[model samples]
Target: MHTTYLRDLYHLHWPKVILVMLLLSVTVQEAVSQGQGYRRKHLEFYDDKPIHYGILFAMPFTRYAIKHNEQFMTGDTAYSIKSPTKAAFRMGFTVNAFLNERFDLRTTPSVSLYEREVRYSYPSSPEKIDKRESTWIEVPLLVKYKSQRRVNNRMYMIAGITMAIETNVRRGRGGGVGTLDTKSTDFTLDYGVGFEQFFEFFKFAPELRFSHGLGNVFQPSQNSLGKGIGRLSTHTVTLYLNFE
Candidate 1:
């Protein structure tokens, strides 16, 4: 009787254990097959083309690097000089020529509209602010170095030079004081990093760039504000979005 009871127990549980083992094996095999079939590559042929064209829009914050003259230290009444950064807009078209797999030469021509302010504080009176506005036609020539594309994204660094011609300059007058006078042309050194994303239709890149003027933009005149300032150079930070 004991032997018969043990035989019946073994027969009842053996099929359930086999069924669980088979289901687990099937699930693992399906997962392995799906993993082997998945592909990570997107826009696999994007870099094969030699040249490309694109449009870019940029937002820039610009300021002046002010150098104070001897008057700032000697004069008792004029205590401090400060220039604050201001935001601007830029829109342009891009022309890219590929030199090789890792390098490209680029030129972008754009129009920028910006405003800057210079503030002066005195010991006896309230602070005075000088506002200046400019509309500039800018051209930049850059060399870009890119890393190997990984999946759908890549990283790049760019360095270049830019020439900016100010087409219009506007100023305001207050308290019988005149606005700042600046040169119409400026040359800047540009350096930046960008991240590129490739999709089926196009490539998109967003960049952050810094520009430092190599030339002194200050135009000195007999005016009190101009005479007190020794040197003024342009400094700008720009964020660019490009579609190619």
Candidate 2:
């Protein structure tokens, strides 16, 4: 009777003892592996340089933000106006000046091609499109704020101002009868967020940025197309791919 009772107790508790032993083994293995495996950081001293250069490629979606006058509400010709979104491409080079571990002063000079449009709808006719095409030379001075680096990545934020000059302006032949002229020089406020990914030989960063024109680009002309518009400013969203 005693041996039979002891055997029954062993059978009942053996499963629980085996489960506990398995769990403890797994926990010890994980702790040991974590303590042994250490990640090697990529480009461990990249930001230690005082200055670095990079090339940039970007795609920009642009629009004309218009402020209309009273004529738009009570106009004889065009009762409505709209500026459609257009996309363009740009290329540039970066010049960076490192101030500290967290901050840097930078500039990128780029050239972009733009095709902007304004559409007018009349009570009596189909829509008229006013198309203007030009090339822009832009220089942006920016301040960059960087986060603590991970193993192979870092995050950053940038804010700055841009100076742009319009060149090679042309009115589309398929456009409306008159032209809506814009000023050559403009200024914009730019802000963006980016991430830097490191590799063995170089670093690549991807950024999304926004730009708002500080000055009006519209050149006031006594034309039927822009008669209802008082101000035209530029708005842009760009995706930048950078290589260093």
Candidate 3:
């Protein structure tokens, strides 16, 4: 009975899963090939030697949904975002060193900027809204693995640890009256997998990466509204541009 139920669920969700896998495979193959090609050609131009510097520009491709998943602590007193679902954009840069054709070490330092808005509506009163714009600078040291160099690009995978500096986090109301500034910093674990395609002058790779924060970014125990909402970590996805 359990096996039958598992098979039924798989049949229902298999289409989406297969599509995602296909897309991931194609893109990663293209990216790895491109990265390999660029390294070879650039090295030939500079005294038949290898170039260690690889530069990539990345941005998140996914949409931001609602923070509907609640973290309830002590009944209705816990804090949460009261707004509907929304989307956000994040971008950053990375520079990597080639240890070999299939293995490399990369230092990815990025800046992400986004805004969060929380609102509450009362039965017979006006809605209360709170807004915050935050930016973070993160550095990740990654070890990358790729398929053998070939004319057709191979897929690549990266695993790394990221140390993030929460450069600036500030909040202000719609009228810009209630404003609070928080300069914060923290650490995190970063992991991602993607593929690259090699063009004549540039390499393009769309990567899906996730970073989980290790520490709280907020200070003290009180919030802007005197309600205690602990610090929240940032999460992102990035598309990378590689230049040799």
Candidate 4:
């Protein structure tokens, strides 16, 4: 059943997955064929510039990393907690400042829209699902380390910290009577690896990044539902497409 559910989820996002795979395949082929010296390199002097600018579009799958309190074991046997992940979209602007030949400082400001659900299952009662929708404005400061450029392709890694402010914190009560409150702001540490492919007109980078919240986002309230959950933190995996 778990496998079937995961398969269905993948099918729902097959278009995005296929597009990423195609980009990767094309980049690899271009890199390999360049060794035969059949094609001239594009943007040969692109990196020599002191500053570069670009825009990025990303798809992120986000979830909550839940920590349970002692009440979970001693509380009502009918209560259980389950959190599920959901996919979302983000668009941003990227500014890169060349610090050296192989290192760069980058800042990306983006807005994210996503939804998350926390479900409570009860044997004697109907299941309850609490849905939280948020709109976040996030700014990430990253340091990118690049390998030596080979022909028109290069590989790089980036690590950074992001500060995000939640603009909307609406909660929907579904089969549950209480509200789940979250903090207005959150901080996260992020890291990722990417391949950069340079073309005549621009540079294209496809990256896979992971982010973990540094602080607990759960805001305790008087509600029983809030008391049941001990701590909640954000976790995300993002696929990014950047054009420079």
Which one is best on TM-score?
A: 4
Between prediction 2 and prediction 3, which has the larger lDDT?
Answer: 2
Worst 10 residues of 2 by lDDT: 1-10
Ranking by lDDT: 4, 2, 1, 3
The digit string of per-residue lDDT tens for model 2 on 68-158 reads 8888777636766767667789999998899998999999899998888888777789878888688999999999999887666677899
- Give the higher-TM-score candidate: 1 or 3: 1
Candidate 2 residue pairs that clash? none
Residue pairs with backbone atoms closer than 3 Å in model 1 (clashes): none
lDDT per model vs. reference:
0.79, 0.79, 0.52, 0.82
Question: Per-residue CA lDDT of candidate 4, range 6-97, in tens?
Answer: 74366346545645785677577766776687667899998789999999999888888878788776773536676676889999999999
Would you give me the overall lDDT of model 1? Answer: 0.79
Better of 1 and 4 by TM-score: 4
Q: Give the backbone clash total of model 3.
A: 13
lDDT of predicted model 2: 0.79
**For residues 80-165, what per-residue lDDT tens digits would candidate 1 score against the true structure?**
77676677899999999889989999988999998888877777898788887779999999999998876666778999999999
- Flag the better candidate by lDDT, 3 or 4: 4
Residue 145 of model 4 has an lDDT of 100
